[model samples]
Target: MRAMYTCSSLYMCGTRDSIRVAMSKLCTFLRHFGVVACIIQFCILLPFLCRTLPFSTYYGVTSGRINFQQRAKMLNEDRVKHANLYFKNMMASESYRHYHSIGNGTHMYLAVAVVTVRRSGVKRVNESMGYVLQTAAGIDSFARSRNFINRTFVFICNVDSQPHKHEEARFLEPYLPFTKRYGSSSFSVKDIQLPHSDLTYDEKMHKNTREKETFDYSYCLKVAESFHPEYVLMVEDDAVPHTDLSSVLEYSLDNHLVDKSKGTPVKKKFAFLKLYYPEKWQGFAFELPRVLELISIGCVGGGVSLLFGLMVRSSKTKLTHWTMCQYFVIGVIIFMLTAELVCRQNILELRRLSKYLYQFRQAPGCCTPAMLYPRAIVEPLTTYLTSLPSPQHTDLAIYDFVIQTQTPAYQLEPNLFHHIGMHSSLGTGDKDAEHFVSTFKIK
Candidate 1:
């Protein structure tokens, strides 16, 4: 029995030794190749990590798909909240009553013309109200808060030829000065005649719509001119003004429009100052300047990482493999590249830290939601627009005219207006309306 017990103990000890040997071998193998395996795994999972990680926690700027989803959800909630508030205020009739009672027909420093038509058969969170009421409420709220009612003139240019059909415009008439285009003596469909003699049925319909749109815009400009304000702001009825609209406009006028030395206006610097541009276009696109900037950043990051790796390798004699240093530098470069790609939206949010620090760039072509035009350009722009032989979209027509005339047009960064319209008044539904709403940054 004693001999059997000793043999069993020896067998157990041998088994333990064999297990230890196997573990040692495994550790040596990992020491030799673990870095490469780790790098491969990290590269494979980088995109997924970026999408899921909450970058806002570190950067104080919202980023990542998860963060964006949260932000979009919050925006929808805020929209619902604002809609309810605006509805209540409009219903009370006390908010805008004083502004309405103030007489129009006096010259003002600024004239804001809201060009709108009746939009029907559209779905909205607030069924009783559309974008116009919310927009009007926003404008009224801004004007009253800023005490701009006396110095600034606000009016609605209902371009819906049939005034009775536009009940919202009619409802707003008592609260703000409203003008209808149907019976205006100064505007006529004949005056905006375009060459559509050879066009097909569909083409003619489109052409007519485009011509009418241009006519409506031109008429609004003319109406604004009649007020004889130094600056005329044309706002689409569906474009809701941001809370910073008043301050930004004032800043723009003071800084960009006026000559500081003489304290006189130099309106020729720009044809018009755009208050809003599409949020999608504002991202870091692969333009030449942006590419150059990115490359420079990469070079700087690579240099710093290379230096860091060299310093560590020199200090630690154990890290003798040159490949270790190379891997370290490469890993850092990859990290920087990943951060740049993943945190693009967060990087953009950095620009919004200060509302007044926005830079002006050349105006980009597309929609015209909110534009502040100089009084000097009003008559000339109207004449140039009317002279176009072919019917074109108002925005395209204006862009063409700017290019042809060599007019220096500028657009503000961090848009001061939010485009809230789901339906286009130009006879088309916005297919990307949901995308716009989701991506729009309130800051």
Candidate 2:
């Protein structure tokens, strides 16, 4: 009996040991399985995360600052700390940072994003910048009448990153209003420079200017998203906004004045509000006003035909009305050529009524000389702009994104802004772009 009891106790101990071993094996397998799954996920998703991520958490981004050596010589670790804190407080900067509010609830409503570079023999930027400020003041005045308050801030994006260029452009400091004032100021600067060993936009450059411009423009656009303005006024340095800018924007945005009354398909289509064009002007000149030119052509042409008909009796049949009309047209063409020259009066452009009155569903966005975009689209626009593969020029890239998103865009008639520079910044006097020819050049 004693031997049997001892055998049973040993058997129970062996069973208990076997159960413990099985449980431990199961725990080990789960641990290893979880680790392997996590590793796979990390490998699969890292590339995508590198491409797109919400980076607004960092408030004070001084990444693209030029004159890095100067920054190091004149600055200390405090600037680094500012950048660190910017990232530290990134997620909360949903809307405004320091520029939005001043005191007593005063706020800024408009932001003009201008991308500029150095241009030799260029005075158009000066006039253009002045007009932009005047437009800001105009907005202020209009807002005051309605008992609403607002401010318009300008963001000048300089694409040159070389320290020497900074020295050359030092004279531009007054109009830019930065480099001293920090801590949530209305203005800021960035250098979208590339590592071009010694390639200027002039010589057979190492890098593609089109690619560089797109990136630089993209960088400025991303910067604008951080400001959180009500509407983004995208303008080029060498361009001017119209005098009635405030009235036009106010009328367009508040009332949907473009296609609101037309009851057309454009009312439901995506759109852009363009403010500048070369042939477009303010006041009476809105319509190309070629009425006198057309009349002169016809009369001069008709008289010449009649004199020739009297001199040489070539046709025996009586003249029909159609024959006389053809003769009149021929005379008109002759008069047009002899009168001035085919410089500004493009027959095709003359026919479009858009030259006379504000048009809805603006022409395809070819240039960003002077345009407006709502703040709501900035975030998505940034994402879309950055995500494109091997984009073309910045203007077309942005327009494509706008179209893809189905947004309404409008263009001012008689062009609220005018091209102000004749020379290009990509290279001295380069005319690779058609718009760059007489002042619409973008750096």
Best by the lDDT measure: 1
Q: Whole-model Cα lDDT per candidate?
A: 0.65, 0.47
Q: Looking at candidate 2, what is the lDDT of residue 338?
A: 31
Candidate closest to the true structure, highest TM-score: 1
Off by over 4 Å in 1: 1-81, 90-107, 120-129, 147-149, 183-207, 261-268, 296-340, 343-346, 439-443
Model 2, range 339-435, lDDT digits (tens) per residue? 3232222332332343334444445567777767766766666556555657577788877877777775666555665454444555454332323
- For each candidate in turn, the TM-score is 0.68, 0.46
Residue 334 of model 2 has an lDDT of 55
Model 2 root mean square deviation, Cα atoms: 35.7
- Candidate 2 overall lDDT versus native: 0.47
Candidate 1 lDDT tens digits, 319-342 = 446655654556556645654655
Query: How far off is residue 191 in model 1, in Å?
Result: 13
